[model samples]
Target: MGALQGRIAWVTGAGSGIGQAAAIALAREGATVVLTGRRKEPLQQTAATIKDDGGKAVVRPGDLMKASVVGRIATDIEKAFGRLDILVNNAGLNITERSWRQLKPEGIDLVIEGNLSSAFYCATAVLPMMRRQKGGVLIHTASMAGRVVSPLSGTAYTAAKHAVVAMSHSLNMEECVNGIRSCVVCPGEVATPILDKRPVPVSKEDRAKMVQSEDCGDLIRYVACLPPHVCINEVHITPTWNRGYVAALQQAHVGAGKK
Candidate 1:
């Protein structure tokens, strides 16, 4: 039997990228995965893949930014499964006009709502059930931007991601007493569809060197498989050939030539 044979896992943003990969990984471990995303078709596709692999999945698409929608989804999950064992709060977004110079009020609102508020809503929705069960796991897919300020990710995206990290740690502080664990995953330069939203295009070679969605998925599965008494507060993963480090090196070389 799989370690999570009787577990119920809810994966947000399961349409594609890390979320899709995470859902599949969890299901393979014998968990019944409930997939949620903004688009119904992608969620359906994810469910289909899981079903084809002899795993189980349910597709429930909705706008997670809305608290009412999140509440209803949580309520439905409780009715269908009685308890929620794991929550992958992985939904997030970044826009091309992310810098302060180009950022509009609307852009800030959109980024914050999608990256931070949506996660907040989902986490809040599932806490009650997790508390009742006396044990659960919440995994937030934050970014390296959450830990460091970078021009590549822009102001709004960085701010929202940082908030996500804070949110996860805060959850652990209060929820660990109830056997609930929160893990914030901070990954650097992942090659996902979100990369298309970058102000400057990332080279194919760079994308290849970056972390893949499946890598993050496997990480999430590892966290979920840990004993209930064990809690991994935070994890920071990055590609071996980190782009930020390379860029700094190249810049230093050019400055040395001019000196």
Candidate 2:
């Protein structure tokens, strides 16, 4: 049997990219994965993939930006699974604007809600169940932007991600005694659909050079499989090629030419 056999894992943003890949990975390890996302069709697709691979998965579609919906999702999982072994807070988004001057108030709110507030709601909702069970893992899919600013990710996204990392640390500090572990994963320039939202569009070649969703999925699986006594508080992963630096240099050269 796989390491996570009989565990119940809930993955947010399971429709595509890292979230979908993580869901599949957890299921392969024998977890009964509950896939949550804003859209039902994509969530269904993820579930189908898991089933095809002889893994179990269920779709739970809802807008996580709403605290009420996040709460309902947690309650639903409890009713179905009796306990949740893992919660992957992977849902996130960014507006196309990178500069603060270009960022509208609405966009800022959207980014905060999508990337930070939703995670907060989900974590809180699952805390009670995890506490009662005496153990659970909470993994947040933060970004490298959380550690350092990047023009590509935009200010709002960076701010939200930074907060996510901080939030994870706080959760760990408060709940480690309760047998709850929180980890923040900060990946650099992953070739996910969210890349399309970058202010500077990533080229196909560049995307190929960047980290892939499956890489992250595998990492998360490893994290989840660790011994109960071990807790990885934070992880930062980046592509070997360092595309962000290369892109910045290229832009600088172009600006020099224009000058």
Clashes of each: 0, 0
lDDT of 2 by residue, 183-234 (tens): 9999997999998876667799988988999999999998888878889999
For candidate 1, write residues 1-259 as lDDT tens digits. Answer: 7889999999999999999999999999999999999999999999999999999999989999999999999999999999999999999998999767888999999999999999999999999999998999999999999999978899999999999999999999999899999999999999999999987898999999999999999999999999998999999999999988998999999999999
Per-model C-alpha RMSD: 0.9, 2.6
Backbone clashes in model 1, listed as residue pairs: none
TM for candidate 1 is 0.98
The models' CA-based lDDT, in order, is 0.96, 0.93
Estimate the lDDT of model 1: 0.96
Q: Who wins the TM-score comparison?
A: 1
> Candidate 1: misplaced stretches above 4 Å?
none
